[model samples]
Target: MNSDGANDMNLAALLRAGADDELQPDQKAHLDAHLRDHPRDTDRIEFERQLKEACGRVMGPISAPPALRERLIASLDRIAQDNSPRQEASSTAPAPESVRLAQGVESLSEQTRRQSFWNRMTPAVRALAAAILLLVGGLFLLQVVNVGSGNLSLAQAHMSEIATFVGDEHDRCVIDPSRAAKFNISELDAAPALLEEIVGKSISPANLAFGGLAFRDGGRCHVPGKGDSVHLRFDVVDQPGETVSLFIQRVADESDELFESGKSYELQSDNQGRAVFGWAADGLNYFLVAKDEALCESYSIERGLTPNAG
Candidate 1:
């Protein structure tokens, strides 16, 4: 081919590649070669990029609807039969007047046969078929609604849990000093091992980013032996005159049971002054929020954790 023809072919190939991001390696190499030949083709380059972006936007997971698939296959089969040689021959055949009359009678008879077949169907059978169709349709509609509603509900529950957990952390920090002084619990000099036990040794120190931890002069101690539970208390210096306490409990058995399930709950502190937003799933239970009973109640209700609230 001449240089002009070759360039045209190259440009066509590039355009095809640009239209779809799923182009093969060789196709990509060919497009690259075209770009090299036509280095100044800015319009073509932008076109290719836009095409790729458009394709990428739609290149995610997809599942076919079962009923739609079944109906499509049935329609295709009917079309194939209608286009078969026997059907075509019948359509093209020229009939005499008498033959045409006979054909009309046969068509009417065939219609009557179909009507009789339908009429012979038992009421139960007809009802059952209608019920099945309605059920399938209802299920499909339910799935679509759940795709939107279920996700939103789950997300809202998660946010509420996190918010409650943060509030609880703050309140715990505020009241820890009073609790320590009242109980004659040494505000200083607790076991470092206790902190490690509750927070999990696997949790990196880098992950501890609590803002409330700076108050109580940055002190930390562990409370031991509450059935595989660890407790931590620290001061938030930046907040000046506030302390926060964190507790980590390892409920392996409960975690295993809830690993594939979702749960929500309201937690109230012994003092009845702190509330917790709790969500459990996949073996982990998280509680978050301030030290208020009302907040906990609201969190629980919003998360569908409270019975008769959802």
Candidate 2:
């Protein structure tokens, strides 16, 4: 090919690699130099980012079904057997013994010997093997799916599902304080800084503390498929028994219709009678939950989370 044509192909390849985040540091430097000469290529970088985000939204995350999980386990077992040293040696040996054994273990002694391998395994060894298999399965499953924040879109989510998580977290931390240690509870004074560090934004107490409730404790909690989030527990100054929880999660897209600015959505009450309300602001999703719906609504209004509050 001509020299100009070759340079064109190289530039195209570099642009694609850079866009996909596969470029080495040296190659990225080259791309930077090229962008200086041809600023138009910068548009390609933006286009690729948008394309990747769009694809993630469309594909979502994939989880293995029970059937698929079983199949994966079986496949892994077969692979392990195929790669085993015993199988390798047997493959090179005379075919007659292997074929005969496959057809039938000719004697009771042969069957007993085959069973001896398992019989010799200690409980600890067997447990270790089982753990290895489970770890392998989990790693394989992760590779087959995208597990990003974009996987859960608040606009399409059922309020019941989100509210259920909020309610459960509240019960665990506020109602049943004995179990709060599981969440790695933080001191009241350090909770705001912890929330800011985790959520990547400064969330002052003024934003979450309201309605005569004072911060009692805060901690991290997992929201199942969504991810880990910070939950701040608040107790009424006068009525110590009355408590509320505010959950803060960093969202992939704060522009979701469900998160329209200054508006709160009331969620379905969980079986435990917790009232849940949620809103999104500044790239963070907030959930306010309490035993009394009136208390939750009052807090939402106080925080300017309700549409009419403004």
Candidate 3:
């Protein structure tokens, strides 16, 4: 392209990179010069600055309604599974409607993965993605903060909410490893040690047993109005397709009747026969998801993970 065309291209790149903090020194310098030379472009820069500021506020973060976030994360997994090149049994993707939604989310996920890619997109794309997720569970996020400001209680609604959180978290880590890496627990420490510190509770991976699932990885899960909650991933020994994920987080308390009566653990299974158990332990809430029902049942039976608290 000609010099003017090249400069325009650079300007476009600078605009995109500026929003994503990917602007190189030279590119930023060039952008600054160009903006100074052209007052109209300055307005565009201001708009981008504002947009970036907004995205910073509402990302993956606080008090997002469990139901809404889970719905969105499930969309990511189901679409990816459908589109997976490995799924040659059927060449068709999900309905166009679902595909479109998934594409939008995956596209955002991909762009956000790399600073350079995010820096190359137009402001319109960035604004659309940031707004979409930011709006989900926003009201619920506010509510979480509000409740947390007061005493923490496991109200009926909160009980159901935590249940769904565990279920979705299980899928998030297993269904799509790449997506789950967004909140990966990469700290350099043993799983139990990290959990003790991060969640402010004490528990051992050996104690949890996980029904013969070997501990593979562990990390924190973020919820609105909550800090870092540990999510530990495990794989069933010698079982290629079976996986287990456990989430442990500090809670207000479990002395209430909801988690007692020897029926504290709830076993939920899907049509595919996958089952997950959620319960409160002393003070920490735990969700253990089993990917293979047969193996999980055998292990759960062995581990005393009956309908009652273990």
Candidate 4:
């Protein structure tokens, strides 16, 4: 490749890395210098940003069915309450096949004539068929419970990480000039048509200056191991010392169970005196973190995190 082609390729690679937040400190500094000299390179930045946003919405949230969730919760409660080994259900039960046919299922004679073949068949075949069906049913139920438990465990694990990130970004916003409200919401919302078509809502910058809060500064950070996210800082109305900030990122698969897609949750505490909570919409995760719990709740509600927001 020619010199310009090589530079373009290098910049393109940097943009993708920056988009995914996979940039190392030195590489990030390198990208900043390149963008500083090559203003047109800002286009790459925008493209990468939108691409991350679009990807966040790539697959809709997957969650356990309500029935499965309930079963898992019950199982978890049981485990929590009693650490001692309990008798397995099977160990306490009588001959299952006999019990099933004698009580749970109709006897061969009681069954319709079409099923009388069950009686004509060898007892071993009948027992094997019943056992297979029971085994399959048991496996299926265990799978459903496992799926539910696994998802919830994952979502819970992300909570601490979220609290940590929100706190760090809040501190960063306190000093970053870019966190100030400079860009209009329309300009912020100017994303590709494909994104709008897929997501339905404008992926534009929202004017979050409300509820005694004014937009201050904002920036984007690509989280290592996680994904890209948007960060915004806000002044606490007139309370200079107090502050509010938020980040919106692509949700992780494990975190998808945090809510039904589009539902909001109220998060609390990083032990750093910050209150946090969030919701997902159109494939993106939205979180608001602030020192003031009331302020966080206010922003959440204004952003449509209704009365029942989790």
Candidate 5:
């Protein structure tokens, strides 16, 4: 490929990596080179800035509640016990066919005439039929319980991760000047109201059924080589202390692109904090991160946002 073609491909990859929080060192270096060569390309500059900001936004520190952490650990322990060999054997074992048949036959006879054809059948045949019915019923009940447990377990696991990420990691915040200008805010001080508005505008009431909003706040800060940006935060009650952060900015030139097909946003945890989620919409780039990916997903959908799962 020609140099221009390679540059374009590298730039696109960098953009994708920015949204996913998976940008590699080589890719970052390539992007830096291109930015240096095309210093006047505001679009290129903003794109690079936004990508870096997204990374910082997702990697910011988070604080989880101690109670939630204890509960999560306890639940995990319970799950371990429930899955132990002895418990598994008891829960999975089926009643003996003969016993099941006897119980069913007794119940049927008590409800219907003793002289009926069903009643007159040989004891063996009656038992067989009863056993079949009991087996079917038991299987159906088992399936229902299994499905419920699966969903609960998934939610539980996500919650646990969120707790750890927020509690142990997030510390510093990053801002993208070009993007931050759009929100008309200077620092974290502008976060709370903006978060409330975004949640109110983007999140549907239906999505709230799975999880409720816990807290919303905002602030300001500087990132290396970047200017002031707005940081908006939202917390959910069920997830407890898990937060979603949104970073917004405005630029005079058209550099960063808005949400579009094949484009993604993400929040990721850094060494300093837990995971975060981020994306862009309506001239704003957003990062929503928590240790609980499931909760983050729900929040994404509620706010009419898509996750950069890639």
Candidate 6:
């Protein structure tokens, strides 16, 4: 290859490594120098950044079910085993220094012979293999989840989006109590009516306040990408720092529908640390997010929305 062609290849490899967050400090310096010379490549980097952000928005918030998670873990292990070297090398054959540098592998000849199988695979081959694995794993996950079965359906994705949004708000307020408006127990009487005016559902705070939970504070909050929602926080009576959040939002809006109407769903958690138990009542969707899974179940049962154990 000509010098320009070789430089193009090197730049491409560096860009890919940077996108994957696998670039070493020296490789990053190299990428920085190349980009300074070729400003036009900035568009490619921007495209990669946008694509990664979009994927995270869509997939990162959703937590896989335990069964599907285990299956994927097992599949990954099997792939690693399959890719493992089958025999000891008779001689120390060194990979090209450029390849070693790009891969962030040691340049020493002995280290080259002991390089990880994944590090040895070309980027093209690794990408193709990853795509194939994702395709198969996605299909397997779909089968395991049994979509459209009325139980835990595809709607969970939408639910997860909402849960993640609320969970983040919950975390922010808890970490910095000053960010949260203090809840007056006296206002509990009018809070339901206020929520009803906005969300069209009136819930009795007495019913939700249980397990040493006392009303802390609440106010209007917005789900980042979706729309408006109402937030209510409760302090675990004896536990100083522990809190729970109750969220009320329209079941469906012009843009997105959170839960299927007339269907009962169970408690679940997004990728966030909190567990979320949600139900649709009247025209509003109610979500209870707490750190304790037992609290989620308790809240669901309190609402008499827990599905049968069958």
Worst 10 residues of 5 by lDDT: 141-150
**What's the C-alpha lDDT at position 160 in model 3?**
40
| Better by lDDT, candidate 6 or 2 | 2
lDDT of each: 0.39, 0.56, 0.51, 0.49, 0.40, 0.54
Cα distance off (Å), candidate 6, residue 58:
35
Ranking by TM-score: 6, 2, 3, 4, 5, 1
- Give a tens-digit lDDT track for model 3, residues 164-212: 4666667756666675664445432476667777877656545656435
Worst 10 residues of 4 by lDDT: 141-150
Model 4, 1-310: lDDT tens digits are 2334334447667877766676767677888888889978778778888877887788656777785576457544433332222223335554454233222111111111222323444666456445543544422210001112113343443543464456655654565645444322222234322223322333433434454666555555543225456665566766877777666665445444344453345544333256665655555666788775545544544454222121
Please provide, for model 2 over 176-241, each residue's C-alpha lDDT reduced to its tens digit, 9 standing for 90 to 100: 557588555445657667766776666655555564678777777664334346878888787768
Task: Give the Å shift of residue 198 in candidate 3.
Answer: 1.3
Clashing pairs in 3: 62-224, 63-141, 63-224, 63-225, 185-219
For candidate 1, lDDT tens digit of each residue in 97-159? 444433332332232223222244467644643454354442211000111211333333233
The residue ranges of model 5 lying beyond 4 angstroms of the native Cα positions read: 1-211, 222-228, 258-263, 267-273, 305-310
TM-scores for candidates 1 onward, in order: 0.26, 0.44, 0.44, 0.40, 0.29, 0.45
Candidate 3 wrong stretches, greater than 4 Å: 1-70, 73-154, 182-189, 223-228, 253-258, 292-310
Candidates arranged by lDDT, highest first: 2, 6, 3, 4, 5, 1
Predicted candidate 6 versus true structure: per-residue lDDT over 70-151, tens digit per residue: 6457544432332233211222565464332322211111221232334544676456445544544422210001132124
- State the lDDT at 252 in candidate 3: 45
Better of 1 and 2 by TM-score: 2
Better of 2 and 3 by lDDT: 2
lDDT tens digits, residue span 1-310, model 5: 2344335565566655544455456666666676678765547556677877887889876778675587568645533432343334445665565433333322221222212323444666456545543644422110001112113333223323332332322322222234333334333334444434543223222322223554354544221112234445555576564555544432112333323322232323222134444334444444455554434433444343322221
Pick out the ten consecutive residues of candidate 6 with the lowest summed lDDT: 140-149
